[model samples]
Target chain A: MEIKQIAEELVSLVREGKNKEAKEKFYSADIISIEGNGDKVEGIAAVYEKSNAWMSQIAEVHSASVTDPLVAADHFAIGIKMDITYKNGYRAVLDEIGVYDVNDGKIVAEQFFFKS
Target chain B: MEIKQIAEELVSLVREGKNKEAKEKFYSADIISIEGNGDKVEGIAAVYEKSNAWMSQIAEVHSASVTDPLVAADHFAIGIKMDITYKNGYRAVLDEIGVYDVNDGKIVAEQFFFKS
Candidate 1:
């Protein structure tokens, strides 16, 4: 899979709530995921665990949409809009842009930018 | 100017420290600018003032680079990496993604995503 194809497929899987599958297929073993605040999670397993922890806090997923992916060499970015209700009944709509750095057809680094 | 052209030119002007000229040439009179915190600044004049205030805080810009822009219809995004020394002697490197929404060949809205 090329960078663009990998990005598109991963985004499709995520939009369908198949994040684990997407990670299994597209992430490199030594993947590094960086949050907007500069916190880093090293390794694919760590990234998955972080994502799962976040999902566990959501009471309901109202809606989600992934925008067209943008590519620049081995880098790709996708915009995401998600509406969710948390366990505390707080509802929020989040807009985020995720940038993925690919190497050898696998995502090596991923960073997210969003309002918080 | 078309969306892509406008975006490229605006970024070029900014990188050259000609942001005021860029704003005058590319921004719509009724432009709205949104920050990562969801705070909004309305009108071109207001946006210019915001930019000036930010610049005033910087003692020196050690380095800056504007990445290749990505375009989708009337929307475009550019990544910026800036290393700066603030007036208070605090030095920080900031990475930000700026998204622009264009209408009628002028920038009508702009939004920035970054870590504080």
Candidate 2:
């Protein structure tokens, strides 16, 4: 798949709340994921565990959105916004840009940028 | 200056090739700038030196463009594309997403995401 196709599919899956499916379909086995605060996790399994842990803490999701990607070369970026309440009674709005790198038709890396 | 105003003015200055002026007008004195390759520099003066060093190596700029910002909260992201030839006879097209964090009307941090 081309970068644009992968980007579109990834965004579509994410917007539809199929983040796990999207990762399974597009992410490389040794994918590296980095958070805004500099936490880094390598490999698909580690990434999934990290994501699942976060999901388990979410009490409710009020709203969410993934913007159209800005595609450039083998890289693409999208803006993501989410309003949610955690199980601990913490409600917050999360806004960030997710940048992805595609190589040999697979997503090799994803790094997020935001103000914490 | 509100986030919107600062964002607009910064984009305008960058579009006009007045990056130094933009930094002076919109960036905090202790701004942190991180490159796509994970090189982090603290302070505006250090950032300026790094930028100037890169600029001095560019033989010619064929084209450059900055996309309209995607603003969310006190953060914003923009796509930047540049085609250039270096003094060492190397030519390349650079594409990246720049994410900025604004605080008290000044841009306190910026990070670039790109594939090396």
TM-score for every candidate vs. truth?
0.57, 0.93
**Model 2, residue B78: C-alpha shift (Å):** 1.3
Cα lDDT of model 1 by residue, A1-116, tens digit: 77778888987898888979999998899998987556999998798889889999999999988876766556677877789999989999876667777889898888776543
Winner by lDDT: 2
- In model 1, where do residues sit more than 4 Å from their true spots? B1-20, B23-76, B79-116
DockQ of 2: 0.53
**Model 2 spans > 4 angstroms off:** none
Residues B1-116, candidate 2: write the lDDT tens digits: 88878888888999999999999998899999999888999999999999999999999999999988877778887889999999999999998888888999899999887778
**Residue A34, model 2: Cα distance from true site in angstroms:** 1.4
- Report the Cα lDDT for candidate 2: 0.90
DockQ of each candidate's interface versus the true one?
0.08, 0.53
lDDT of 2 by residue, A30-115 (tens): 99999988899999999999999999999999999999987877888888999999999999999888889899999999988777
Which candidate's TM-score is highest? Answer: 2
Give per-residue CA lDDT, model 1, range B1-116, as digits (tens): 67678878988898897878988998899998988666999998799899989999999999988876666556667877889999999999876667777788888888776653
